[model samples]
Target: MAGKLNILFITADQWRGECLSALGHEMVKTPHLDALAADGVLFKRHYANAVPCGPSRASLHTGMYLQNHRSGTNGTPLDARHTNWAKEAAKLGYDPVLFGYTDTSQDPREEDPESPWLLTYEGPLPGIRPVAMMGTWPTPWTDWLKANGYEVPADIRYAYGERAPGPEYEDGAAVPRPLIYPKEADDTSFLTDRVIDYIAESDKPFIAHLSILRPHPPFVAAEPFNAMYDPEAVPGFKRKTTHDEEAAQHPWLEHQLGRKLFRAPAVEKKLRRMKAVYYGLMSEVDEALGKVFAFLKESGRWDDTLIVFTSDHGEQMGDHWLLGKCGYFDASYRIPLIVRDPRKEADTARGTEIDLFTENVDIMPTMLDLIGAEIPVQCDGASLRPFLEGRAPATWRREAHWEYDFRDPADDSAEKRLNLTLHQCTMNIIRDEKFKYVHFTKLPPLLFDLEKDPDEFTNVANDPAYLPVVLDYAQRLLSWRMNHDEQTLTHISLTEDGPVTRRAARY
Candidate 1:
């Protein structure tokens, strides 16, 4: 803690919180991440505040809730006035380099009308330096593939799915086919290589954001990883017996199931195969991370670095008959969070798993606090420094909160389908130890007694017995919102003598 801490912030896309081997998961294997957790404090109940990449990363970077940031959807622009961790870190003499994507949609008011960044939501964060940019197109990885004598696809987006020359399935069941590129040439490997090279070459204390794209899409793994997990052995989903039965729980669930993009494959084998490959991709990323961890240790920078490993959001992975990250299920919002603080003060808490409720908004404050920077007043989350030092705050949050906005501005698809206006196409979740209450802006509410039905199969919102519980949780959600509403300038006022100000106490 004497000198500035070097920060290695990593995120694997669409990873489930329960998939880590250290968590005693039955199917997936994440040995490298497990090792990191063994040396760090693992947060068992951490969650993302929003769904999809743009809004969730907005919350993660700015330390604000979705309601405060207002970057509701994938293409929604983040307000340019807001200060992010990257910008704050830069003020303290850190370069704040990015090795992969942030999924930020640049504010149009700050850009030219002819700018190409305006067309894509994959714009870099305002203050960060994107050294190896890999967004939706992934030109850097694809270019590496072509340079290595591998045939690149005509459309670069299909690079991840370019399969090797072989039949896709064994017998009649679907199997995850291997991609043409080897594990060394994979996107995850490319990002890892970039991070290692940058860290090795940097002379100053480095701050690098390694955002890896894996376990996210295309669901295909390279060579050995594709065959790592057996489709038959993977665990069954947490959904009801049939899709229709799952849809009957709520109208929002029904609408999501009706969409082809979110619906799980009808074929049982196909769904199982995708799940297997998803696990495989996670292991592959873990392997790539092993190299980075080893490099840090071997270079003698391990003890001075503060490593934060997490995901922007969680993947449903066919839970509740859905395949993507959205809706009210815990599978879509809950994500893994491991913080390895290589200081003597953190030794007592190493390998300890804390069950306190944490959210993506807390990430920014944690990083800012560790680096000796003043956390912005706009941050809705409290820092995890106390937890890292083996002490819990006197008063901590008992529940996790998240929001999902399904508005499609370009087409208004959700609005037309759900009979809601753009502002009404939103849902907020309040989940505690034994119950979860989902409040939609204009739609019906959903309450689940988690202790009785852990899988969230039944809705008790309208059951007369649970009406009081529903009202209580609704009030709690409103109180939480009102308390955490944007406070950037609310604490400042002009007095007759001078301007008076008070800092917002995050905890």
Candidate 2:
């Protein structure tokens, strides 16, 4: 509303929406993010439209659903034809820098089939300039460590956790120990330092996407962070007492609960320890981010920067006997979103909390709208510019919709085990304030009364008393799908004068 604003988009991988201290979480403390919310507006009900980094970031970057983008799995490539925020920002003469991994699978059609990029899902997104890129291997950070006299492990994952010297568990899940690296050398710290250094060198209005991987796997924290919380004092999990109890609820849950990698720790104490470490990791990230906030303010860029903080998706962290982000659970999809616009016009809405059902797709459009850039017609999300300007849109969504395409194209392990076709391995969820409805491609549907059972321990889909609610939600899901189906070419037509395009003129 005043000057050309610099965009700082930060994402924390696998961070749950409820973990923010500003949002009144009991255990975790995020003082920096709390300060951010105090200076900005927070969307309390933002959800990711897809899961497992690749599919979710595909929607986040392209502003399209999994159905429209078709990048269903981690190794799946995003179609090259689609336009992304990075490409659009590049059109406006910005480099659109990326400080961390985007989890984008390279489009095979544009490269050699044997190209190294095709081998992993950690490839950089199409148009962004990589100021620094850290992935599962994290060559950049590892190299930095090596240069600084730190021993680099062949498998970088070992640096995150230690396995006990004793015999492993029956399921082969090793005991997770605290990180071997120092607090300053942690991944979150390294990335934040890199971003601060990059911002220092830039004089132009820039768009930087910082993707942080913390409070995510390995369940390890460094130094005081590892000792920040007591495992015994951690909040209790909102899951069934045992895995079998969860599995008995649905066929999908049974299959999901059987996966060793996603299963919660068998020992209750060990599970609570994992949760304590997770909260510590979150606290570490918050501390690391505090440096960024300090840098922005010290450099006098705070007033001209639009800061956005959110996660790609959320982790279950023992919720429903699950550890990773997947299935139809709210813990897997709900993510925190905070936007701080420092323009004088946005002062009225600063420190405000908007209670609207928002999704990851809305992010791209919101950025474009703020920068006065043209929003692509292909985006399924609407901009939140009105909210930042202290006005509600005439019409806003009342429900949050998310989809998880669970097909493993390489192994097809799920297909054979679950007796499902690759095409039938998907699930979609529609959740309103009061109720949530989960529909699988080829499995039994699930209905949860959020008001009565927030933990979602009970599925009331088959209850005669709730039949009307289920039917209504089912129809709403159908209507949502019909309304959001792909329309890339729908607005274009060949008229008597020539070809006419409704949205093409803006670009």
Candidate 3:
């Protein structure tokens, strides 16, 4: 409290909360995060608003539920008319900064004056400047290598195992193990080095978000970690074969690309190796992050800094026979979240974990609350500070929410659309302490009693006995949409000075 506070926001691309040792995953070691948790608070049941980068981040940075600001996928651009945290932070005299890219794409309607989604697509929210907007993850790695005098391959990506002499698929190497220091330097290490350097010189009340890429595909790790775990050592996904088998129910996963791409044939052995490498990559991130935290502690800035650790979303790994996150399942939507308040409270619940439902969408509001900034009235998430400090608002929803838009027909031909047009096969999920409801727009809905089907092996949505349960969830889902939709259903008036103007419903 002696100086202007610093906010260290660390976000990984697709990290699973269960992957951390602190969370009971014995495979990975996150000592620094563990240490921070010792002095901070960890949320055991946090989820993501959406999966696969863009949409998820849109919700995170904007503090809005997916329904309110629907950028539903990676290619969809968020509408810029809304407000974002960094923009508001700037008004508070703090120079909010971003270290990595915000996958938020430009709304096509705005980009192309004639695009259909234009009236439909939301644009970027205002505020926050990316101090370092390395176009994509590759740009950051390449830049770091060059700056450090390391020669990086222009062909930045390579597959782990060769698939004969074909066009190189971005899938990573076949070998999975512990972290191996590169002949020069690893991307994970390099990015962290840059982050450490930036924090060292930063004198402002910095709000830095370090977005890491790893354990994502390209499952390659530096070394040592490259060959870390034995397949058997890493737990097998609870439902693999059944998952892909079920994919037939969903069009996107059944498409040619989805089918052909992955470590398939259920290579249990290879998967273990892949997971080992994934863990190795994770450790590398942990090591890099530890340095940043250590520096803060050593510089005596630790007390004034608030650090939050979470991922944009969770990866499916081999869960439900899927690779990466693109579904409405737990592996794809559930993420990890830890908030380390710099005050370092006494009775400081070190390694303290809360099971209350939480999600990345709540992140911005939490940060705003800590900085004493005004959270926009339109925000959907409640501040996490209350839960982190062991307080839960009575109004908090017992169930966490997540959404998925079926693929746009033009791009990949999915069935979630009304008639297979530009829209996607949409699925909405509402997860509570024990039950989960996954409602696909036109497809068979899925329901699970998490208490019994923790792995989600049983789909009860079709069971007659569970019809009532399904109805309850469906109603909730509908209510959620009605409360948060763009208000496209009704005609309202907007006043310029006195009142405004009125418009009729177009759609």
Best by TM-score: 1
- What tens-digit string does per-residue lDDT give for candidate 3 at 1-507? 222667888887788878887787767888877887777888889899886687888899988877778778776768777678888777788776666667776655446687533543223334656665442335666666677676555565432211223221123444443332362366566666677777788767787777677667667666556655555577767554554565554454455225545324365666666666677778777887888888888987788888898998887777666677776678888877888886544244555788778877688888888888887655677787766566556566677888887565355534432355454367788889779888866656888888988887677887899899999999987887776665432444555665443442111
- How do the candidates rank by lDDT, highest first? 1, 2, 3
Runs of candidate 2 with Cα error greater than 4 angstroms are: 1-3, 162-177, 503-507
Cα TM-score of candidate 1: 0.98
lDDT by residue (tens digit), candidate 1, 1-507: 233799999999998899899999987889999999999999999999999999999999999999999999999999999999999999888999999899999999999999999999999999999999998798988888788788898999888788877676543634678888899998889899989999999888988999998989889999799989998899998888898998899888898999999999878888888898999999999999999999999999999999999999999888898998988899998999999999899999999999989999999999999999998899999999999999978878989999999888787777888899988999999999999999999999999999999889889999999999999999999999998988889998999988899885754
Candidate 2: 10-residue stretch with minimal lDDT:
167-176
Task: Report, for every candidate in turn, its global Cα lDDT versus the true structure.
Answer: 0.91, 0.88, 0.69
Question: Per model, how many backbone clashes are there?
Answer: 0, 0, 36
After superposition, the stretches of candidate 3 with alpha carbons farther than 4 Å from their true spots are 1-3, 108-126, 135-137, 147-149, 157-184, 240-258, 262-265, 344-351, 416-421, 486-507
Alpha-carbon lDDT of model 2: 0.88
- Give the best candidate by lDDT: 1
Error of 1 at 4 (Å): 2.0
